[model samples]
Target: MTDQPPTLPTSMRAGRILGPGHTVVVDVPVPTPGPGDVLIEVARAGICGTDLHILDGDYELARFPMTPGHEFAGVVVALGEGVRRSALGQRVTADPNLPCGLCPECQRGRANQCHDLAVVGVTRDGAFAPYVVVPERVVVPIGELSFAAGALVEPLACVVWGLERVRVRAGDHALVFGAGPMGCLLIQALKASGAARVAVVDLAPSRLALARSLGADLAVTPDELAALADVAPLGFELVVEATGVPSVLEGAVEHARPGGTVWVFGVAAGDAMARISPYTLFRRDLALMGTFAVNQTVPQAVALIQGGAVDVEPLVSHVLPIDAFAEGLRLAAHDPTRMKIQFSFGDASS
Candidate 1:
């Protein structure tokens, strides 16, 4: 970890979301970390579904004219007042959500539900810039893991938190609706959680093909769901709706066994509603649950990615530089075959 120069830059290049469907790369003043904070040189930033929502002005928590990128991995370049230099030059990824410690939700150990929730890349400027400041507490050292793997920790952490909320038992049968990056990760995590057989459902053959390569016992189109009966005659013990489509939830519920659990891990529109039969849930003793962002599971996620339990490399389909970020966003939104599109900046060590 090398010590940084005392004088910080006046301005740095950044991708800003100005208004709905409008974004551009602009020069923004480099932010100084407050006490108990550290500055990171952005290395790689992942484009996620939430980013699309933010760009569309659809995410409730996001404010306009801010740099947008929450999933990132970087190197610590400068330490702030009261912060140790131990992290200087160290590679790391972070949990973006910043909670008010005094909030009732924080007090209840539910910081994800914090009343005054401020998140990097949303409520505050984020890592789309070459350099950004973050609280020291949220940073997790990447150790020997690649920055690409590090950038994935946040999304994997979300899956870890969702697994905590959903009851996944050993030898349980699982069905994941969606073979997208997140859904594919959910498949691996569910398998790692001890599901005897993890079946996948997707509209795309290519995605489903990759799902098979990633260890999915069965991958099929919606019309082929009947084939899943060979593996689980009754129904899947755990059914996860990862597509974030209201109609998918209905199908997910129908795939759950009596007394099974249906976990909704995707982020649908704030006003979107999913219709499910209350009678079926009551009659079958089924549980329907939803999960939000990462809690305290980044470490476990790092372990999974670095430990090789979950494979993330194949999920990456596009790696564009910051200058082409607008094009990257467009491909991420419209490209059907693309899995994960990320923006990789300068060398993390530089």
Candidate 2:
């Protein structure tokens, strides 16, 4: 016999970005799961740089009047027809990328490059609310993991995908620009992937301190970036630009060793441009690449967190209730001391 389904609220308060720089919380009817989907009761949802872009209407894919949250962890509260992968009460997180299967990129196993990609927060309602409905195929069990760390799996998955694409040889020295949440994640992921030493640069002392504590061999402010050369006289084997600042990205290749690789993992403004000397890349034999949002790497991120290779809780500097959605987004956008900001839901209907 089947267990009785729990009662759910008809209406729930959700955060919505109506337009550029305009965000609000409104009471909307809770969404029902369609066939092949599962309804999740969100426990924690993170505010990412992408969310900031969406708030400012800077991300081309973001739709106005949309709820802006995709990185999240929660429990499966209800299951729709044909949903067998996720069951009621299963603790889980999901891959928010919705790539069209017919796309050539998808056929080639590059879903992030899907021409008609429909991301959860960008294209539809997301987890900045009590309930969010996603396809069962994207849901992955967290298996007793804390909801806060579970919420970080999505971002870490992006890191994992980048790692898979980049070259991380054993004992290679690396330099990373930016020590924010994604930057810190990159530091740990690089170390775990066999980088012998990692140096991080940031303008925030607090972030530098956190990066050092989290396994960075060297952490320095932008004013002291010259100190990095002392750690690697020949320059780092790998250089990463994680600040999403055009100027920072422009100079990243200068810090790479001859024949080294430069990984661009930042989310810069759509119209932003960075000038780099192609002659320098040609002379140095440098390989420059970029990885976008999570693409089939959630399972690896889950493994990294569960196996203790990555610590996500330390990156979360703020956790507020859904009532403070705007405050959370504001801090995420302007707070220099902030790392990861998340919204929690104690009362699912609240």
Candidate 3:
């Protein structure tokens, strides 16, 4: 990144998700930056559950043999036609969502809710390569932000959106089920946004321990809820079920205080169903809110990471080379210790 290189090779090394249970590393054409686009030299890319879904062909919009990566940070290498900015050598991160401008949702300024939404990593080539072409509008400057923290902005943006619909008052007691990467981020985000204390529940002790290390007021297994009656005798004011499991979704409402809000923020299977009593919902006057991905929260997410308000550093447990991206997938699937496994495309590190 020292000297601004005039040009790069025609082809570059990249990781491609061929189909269900298939991945390959190969040399592919560096995508041509289109009008109002910027070519990025990928520094790091993070692996998440959605990546697996895309790889397994579970995402309806995903096509076969695609370079799969959504969360990434990089340096601007070149600018496309109609782009007047001097983006070369600038560090940056971008939102992966591509909402159709013609959609009603987009017209209403709710692009995340667009009916014809197309995600970069899911429906098109992403940053798990030496270079990727992204629209200039989605790109956000990562001033003094490390590539590792910058890559986390995408997920943090989603967390910000989750809280946008759910109320988080000062001194509010919160309970979060599922201490995975998103869950952990939710914990920090809640604290930063003014929640008094957060009790985390997860099946794994390691994840719970991480929750505690990250300033969670309480970290306990789901089975230990009975023992925590004295701590939140009435139940939490805010209940978030981060695990996409339907069973967890069904039972999470029970952990919310009467009239308290419940945020169903996880991505459950399209066909998945969680039974909640309509009678109870009416009787308790409880509010059940559903939040989708990030919408206009990228800048705040970037600020949070760069300002050290949310630490995703601990979440990145594995930092492997781009050549081992396939192996990174295996670890993401099987490794419980792995909170976030990222591919280092160049000099990127954990």
Give residue 135's lDDT in candidate 3 (0 to 100): 87
User: How do the residues 1-350 of candidate 1 rate in per-residue lDDT, one tens digit apiece?
Assistant: 32356665778889889988999998888887788898898888889999999988899999888898998898888887888643677899989989888988899999888999999999999988888889998898978888777888899999999998896899999999889889889999999999999999998899999999999999999999889998799998999988889999987888899999999888888899989999999999999998999887888999998878999878888888888879988998888778988788886622
Report clash pairs, candidate 1: none
Best by lDDT: 2
Tens-digit lDDT string for candidate 3 (1-350): 22225567789889998888889999998777888888898888999788877776677778888998999999898888788764788899899998888989999989998899888787889988989888888899989887888888899999998887786989888888888889899999999989888888898899999999998989898788885566678888899988888899788888788878889887776678989988877888788999988888899999888778799888877888889988999988777667878888866442
Question: What ranges in model 1 sit over 4 Å off?
Answer: 1-3, 6-9
Query: How many residue pairs clash in all the candidates, one count each?
Result: 0, 0, 0
Global CA lDDT computed for model 1: 0.88
Q: Which is the leading candidate under TM-score?
A: 2
User: Lowest-lDDT window of 10 residues in candidate 2?
Assistant: 1-10
Worst 10 residues of 3 by lDDT: 1-10
Q: How accurate locally is residue 23 in candidate 1, as Cα lDDT from 0 to 100? A: 91
- In model 1, the worst 10-residue window by lDDT is 1-10
Any runs in candidate 3 off by more than 4 Å, and if so which?
1-5, 348-350
Residue-wise lDDT of candidate 2 within 1-350, one digit each (tens)?
A: 22226588878999989999998889999888888888899999999999999988889898888998999999999888877667788999999998898989999999999999989888899999989999888999999789999999999999999999996999999999999999999999999999999999999999999999999999999789779977888999899999899999888889999989999999999999999999999999999999898889999999999999899899999889888988998898888889999898965311
Candidate 3 lands at a TM-score of 0.95
Work out the TM-score per prediction: 0.96, 0.97, 0.95
The list of candidate 2 runs beyond 4 A from truth reads 1-6, 347-350
